[model samples]
Target: MGLVELAFSDWIGTITLNNPKKLNALSEELIKDFCDALEELKRQSVRVVILRAPAGSKIFSAGHDMRELPLDGRDPLTYTDPLRLAVRTIEYFPAPIIAMVEGSVWGGACELVLSCDIIIAAEDVTFAITPAKIGVPYNISGVQNLIITGGTHICKEMLFAAQPFPVKRLVDAEIVNRAVPIDQLETVAQTLAEQISKNSPLVISLLKEEIRLLSTSHNLSPETFERVQSMRRSVYDSDDYQEGIKAFFEKRPPIFKGK
Candidate 1:
């Protein structure tokens, strides 16, 4: 069976991450399937798309499949990486995409949720960007998404602490549109999707594109961009980076030395 599944009805398309055993880790194959599913749903003229994990799963996603990560010094989240492509696809999708978040959203998955047009999370939901824990240097686009949603203060705290922020805090930070009881999450998300699907598809599509463009309007100079990239490169090339990933697999705390 595919790691991702898509179902459509009444102009609303639902995509469920189906790898409960792996906590829906965004493996390369799964990401490709997800992108393909989005493309198919767009072709069907679905007015709204809902992304979620399979029901009854405790983790919405544990983020990227760490086992797939490279220890050979390549950037895992480079622009052309599968995870980056998946986020880009969601961001530019012609129709609105809503993230129906439950359980915990971690690392790259948090960026994925941030890229969605709207996010409705359950009360039990917790969002964490965990690259700091693994010494991974998060990409600029991902960080921008967080800043756009939650402002610089919230984004800085999330990235530096590498801790989960509860749904209520996210709602306050404007990252989450609403936080509903766990039992009511599905119903609320479905109702919202139905309402969105009733709107004119063309208008919705144009509005989505306008908002995406406007949000990304700020441009960084070439030299500044290269400087940021260089800083990130230094982190990924450091001994701390190796120790972080090693400690993760060894099930221990990483002791990072500023070397």
Candidate 2:
């Protein structure tokens, strides 16, 4: 069976992550399937898209598949990376993509939710950015998404602490559009999608593009861009990066030393 399942009706296309056993880890193959699904939905002229998991799941996503991560000192999140591309696809998708989150979102998956046009989550939902926990250097664009959605202070707390932010906090920070009861999550998400689907697709598309452009409009000087890359490179090239991946596979806490 495929890792992603797609259903379309009433101009609303729903994409479900079907790999529950793996906690819907965003593997390369899964991400490719997701991207393809999005393209197909666009071709079909779906006015709205809802990205979700099966009902009653305890995890929306565990984030990137750790086993697929490169442990050989190579950058794991280059612009051409599958997960990065998938996030970009979500960001640039013509219609609104609603993330119907019912469980904890971690790692790159947290970035995925933030990339969506809107997020309607269960009251018990939580979000955590775990790059620090695994010594991964998050890219500038990803960091910008977090900052745009939750502000600089919230982004710093999540990245620095590598802890879960509860639904109340997420809503308070304006990261979640709506926080409903667990059982009402699907209802709320579906209702919103239906309402959005009834709107003018062209207007929504243009507005989404405008917002995407403005949100990501910041430019950096050549020297500053190089400096940012160097800072991220330092993390990925460090012994801490190696230790973090090792500890994850070894099921132990990594002891990171400033190198």
Candidate 3:
């Protein structure tokens, strides 16, 4: 059996972290499977995605594979190495992504959820980041994501406290979008994905790019701005734009070519 599983239907692709026996702690094979699944979703032009785990787990993920930690329990830089690319993939994926989380989410697991465009958690879910307690500095990318989702103060608390909090508090802090009953987590996540999938694909892709530019454009050099301008020009000249306008005039939904 694979560490991760992916399935698609009706323009929505779902990825499940399947190691429920280990609380779905991400492993080496899981990382590869996840990236491969994302690539497949891109190829299929999946309009939306929902990430979740199989039901009846005591936790969503307990963090890294602690058994692989050094005997002296040193914080291994390699532990976070895979996440750099995985988080980047999550951030730059063309369509919106959502995380459906129940039970406990810790360390890298929290970082994973933060990378998603939206997070819907079970009301009883617990969240934490344990790197600080383990003598590891939070990875810079993960810290940036925490800041983006929860702001500076909450980010500091999560890292400094090194303790888990109920998912509702996270929702209150805007770190998570929805907190539904445990049984309703999948329903809510799927409903949100369906809503996103119903949009114009061209607009969804363009807005994702535009927002990504806006998020990272701060403190950029003039050359960077110029490069961004080039990207903007390219988007304007895309064949999808022509199709979109044609569809508008013809009173029909546009079939975006992603060109």
Candidate 4:
């Protein structure tokens, strides 16, 4: 079976993590498939992407697959490395990406949502990060995305305590864009996406960049700047940038390939 279920309609691409029997945990194959799917969506000019879990399950994800983790005694970075790439793909995706959290999210699952541009959650959803409890360092790159997009204090408390925060707290902390009744979560995200898609994709990307630049410390120390620059250079030089410019002059919606 496909590790992820991808469907597109009305310019919206929906991706559901389908390993529900495993609580939708992220495995090497899942991460690879997810990244590949997002890359394909980037090529297809999909205006928006919604990430969700399978039906009859509220647990969006429980994080990494401990059983599948590499046990060759090699550096664990191998696993985290690929996962980080997946998270970055979500972060720099030109089009708007939304997290539709209809259930529980924990560990790397939380990290994934934190990467999205917006998060819409079910009212009763539980959001937690349990890395500390597992004795693993919460060193994901998306942690900064969480803190900057969410809140500094909120990030600190969550990381330090590694506990699940209620959906209401997630909304209050601004981690999630909004929290609605379970039945309304999808509607909320779709509404938000529809509103976003009406605007010029070129402008949306520029606005995202301008906001990200201001919100992020792009001018940190020289070393840090290099790191951030390295992380984002591909986006700057992507085909989407070229299409955006062409679309502006042509007075039409540009199809971005995310090259």
- Best candidate (score: lDDT): 2
Q: What is the C-alpha local distance difference test score of each model?
A: 0.89, 0.90, 0.76, 0.74
User: Each model's TM-score, in the order given?
Assistant: 0.98, 0.98, 0.79, 0.79
What does the lDDT read for residue 157 in candidate 1?
A: 95
Q: Per-residue lDDT for 1-259 in model 2, tens only?
A: 2899999999999999989989999999899899999999999999999999889889999999999888777878888877789889998899999999977898999988888999999998889899999888888877877898889998999999999989888888788888999989888999999999999999999999999888878887899878998998898899999999899889999999976
Q: RMSD in angstroms, candidate 1?
A: 1.0
Q: Please, what are the lDDT tens digits per residue for candidate 4 over residues 3-90?
A: 8988888878889999877888888788888988888888888888999887557688888765553333233333256668777787
lDDT of 1: 0.89
Write model 1 residue lDDT over 1-259, tens digit each, in one string: 2989999999999999998888898899889989999999989999999999988778999998988877888876798877789889998899999999887999889988888999999998899899988888888878888888789999999999999999899898777999999899999999999999988989999999999889889998999999999998898888998898899899999999965
Tens-digit lDDT string for candidate 3 (102-188): 778988888888888889988888999876554344444567678877899988998988899788888889888989888787888
Clashing pairs in 1: none
**Which ten residues in a row are the worst by lDDT in model 3?**
70-79
Positional deviation of 120 in candidate 1, in angstroms? 0.9
Two-way TM-score contest, 2 vs 3, winner: 2
Candidate 3 TM-score, C-alpha based: 0.79
RMSD of 4: 14.6
